[model samples]
Target: MRAVTYDSFAPDNARLRCGEVADPKVGPGQVLIQVRAAAVNPVDWKVMAGGLDGMMDTVFPVIPGWDVAGVVTATGPDTPEFAPGDEVMAYARKDVVQAGTFAEYVAVAAPAVARKPATLDWAQAAGLPLAGLTALRSLDRLAVGPDDVLLVHGAAGGVGSLAVQLGRDRGARVIGTASEGNHAFVRGLGGEPVSYGEGLVQRLRALAPDGVSAVADFVGGQLETTQAVLAEGGRHVSVADPRVEQHGGHWIWVRPDGAELAVLAAAAERGALTVEVARTFPLERTGEAFDASRTGHTRGKLVVTP
Candidate 1:
């Protein structure tokens, strides 16, 4: 099957190579997915750039991707939650560096796989695994309630966009930060929009002088600025930067849980959730996808349909 694999830690080494690699053998508690769409994420670029090189090793010929949306082609032994033909979406585990969603097939643990929502297509579903779960996990940490006021940074990006919708569904008043171009989109997601620029903190303070009840920084560098504007005792968390604790705030890491995905998928089915696909590229254009995601200020999640 065709997959995106890199030989070195250098971003220049990135390429889409065609080769006849043997299909993955599913082990106990795993499911083989014939990937229809795989979402490109900041994490993908981080891996490609060797941010996790110490962990993943500067391993040559590594297929890198996590978010996947596809149909089950085979089920591993003792897997009883799903059948071979079930449509599923998931985030692959960090431990599996070689086996990823960049290919036409990926063998994902059953615990990370969940039925795709009936309301979403393959591309939309593909965009949910990482960013979507991160947003949900942060909200879960804050215990977001209908009456709460929450702030999300990079509101136009994948996680921020989902956080806006999820915050609204949970009955919170959401304030989202983005550039001028995404104001409408942010407001449409039920967030009060704040423009992101050099004076971001000032803009937020002007709009929310009393501060918000919770603060979630999806964009790492913006943590200090956002946390500065948080209301006293507000829940502060981040998916990218673990240093939030140094600021006397909190942090959250998105965990892969089938039960969590089940709840999130059901919410999507009930029209309480949405996944935004900013752009999509053909499998052969994986290089372009990585470039855009790494260099551009993306409006939403990028996807690759192999």
Candidate 2:
């Protein structure tokens, strides 16, 4: 099988190479997917740069990717939930950093695989799992609902964009922070857009004078702004910063759950959620995709097709 591999943690993504590797073997409770598309995430490049060295163990010549949209070629014994020819997607992160989704094929534990939303094309589907899951988890933790003003940092970003829509779906009045260029894009996602950076707290206060009822910080380094704008008895969560925990907010890490993913898929099928894909690259050009992701300015996801 042809796939991307990095022999060591290269901060510049210089070690990424595309070549033949042994096909993955299906084990019990696993399903083999023939890759169609995979999404590039900041975590992919961060992992490549050894950013997560003290956390997950890396087996080098590591394959780099987690979000995948593909078709099942086979299922291992005891995996009665799916069979050959099923279209599926998953956040296919392993306990160790190897055998990932940036390949011609990948084998995932059945419990982490969900049926692909038929309404989405391959690129969009590939972009959904991780970002959607992160957004979902953040909102669930904050318990956003009607009568609350939800403030989303990085509103036009991959996860933040989805969080805006999901918050709106739950009847919250969402206020999103983005650059001046992305304010309209955030508005399209059903959020009232506010520019981040200087005077952010004042701007948020102008929108919600009592301060916001909840804050979801998708972009880190905004703890001060979050604390300043949160109303009394409000809640906050951050996927990027752990210090949020010390401030009485939750620091969330997304988990792989097919059942939860299925709920997102159903929402897409119902037209309540959508994925924005910024660009698509071929399998061999994954390094370029990582470069785009590292820029930290793209409004949506970058996808790679095999």
Candidate 3:
């Protein structure tokens, strides 16, 4: 098996070095997936940079990828959810390190894997699991609805794009913050776009005369601005920093749930959800993929295929 790995922590130490390693075999209650595509999330590279070291205990030489889409070549004896040949997608775990989708194959716990939507290609399915689930978890905390006004910061990025669409699907009048360049793109998804910059507060007020019923911050900065703009009792949630809660906002963290993933997959199948792959790199170009992910403000998720 060939995998991208880092044996030590450094700000820019991540690399894709190919080596002959043993293939992963299924374990009890696990599924061995022949990985098709692996999506790059900011979390992946953040971990690579060792930002998460204090928060997690792990050995060096760990393979790091959270959002994975692949096929089940084998399954654990105790698991009943999937069989050989099933197409699946999963968010592995926060603590236990993953062999990861960077490899040609990896073993994932059955509980974490769900059938990929028939409507999505490997790249698309691969792109959505982590970002989409983070968006879903954030919006779930907000509970915006038909009469509500929901604002999404960084609305043109992968999670923001899906959050805007999901808020609309749930009947919220959605407003999203993006630069002028992405206004039309955000509008196409049913979100009213507001320019985000120095005067973002004024821009938002100008567009939503009624007031924002809920604010979801996908962009990690100027959270005080996002918080101040929310309507009275409006929920402010983020997938990023939760300390904003101290300033009268809510923080959201993503956890793996096959049930929620199944819902997302079903929505994608019904044409209610879509994924954007801003870029795709072959396995050997994993370094390039990590570099692309490091570039802040990518329009959508980037992917790597093994």
lDDT of each: 0.84, 0.95, 0.83
Query: Where does the lowest 10-residue lDDT sum fall in candidate 3?
Result: 12-21
Error of 2 at 108 (Å): 0.4
Two-way TM-score contest, 2 vs 3, winner: 2
Model 3, 230-303: lDDT tens digits are 77777787778767888777777788777889889988988888997888988778778888877777888899
Per-residue CA lDDT of model 2 for 72-188, tens digit only, reads: 999999999999999999999999999999999999999999999999999999999999999999999999999889999999999999999999999999999999999889988
For residues 58-82, could you state the per-residue lDDT of candidate 1 as single tens digits?
A: 4567777889999999999999988
TM-score of each prediction: 0.95, 0.99, 0.96
lDDT accuracy of residue 15 in candidate 2: 92
Clashing pairs in 3: none
Best by lDDT: 2
Instruction: Identify the candidate with maximal TM-score.
Output: 2
Higher-lDDT candidate among 1 and 2?
Answer: 2
Tell me the lDDT of model 2 at 257.
Answer: 92
Candidate 3's error at 6, in angstroms?
1.3
Q: What is the lDDT of residue 151 in candidate 2?
A: 95
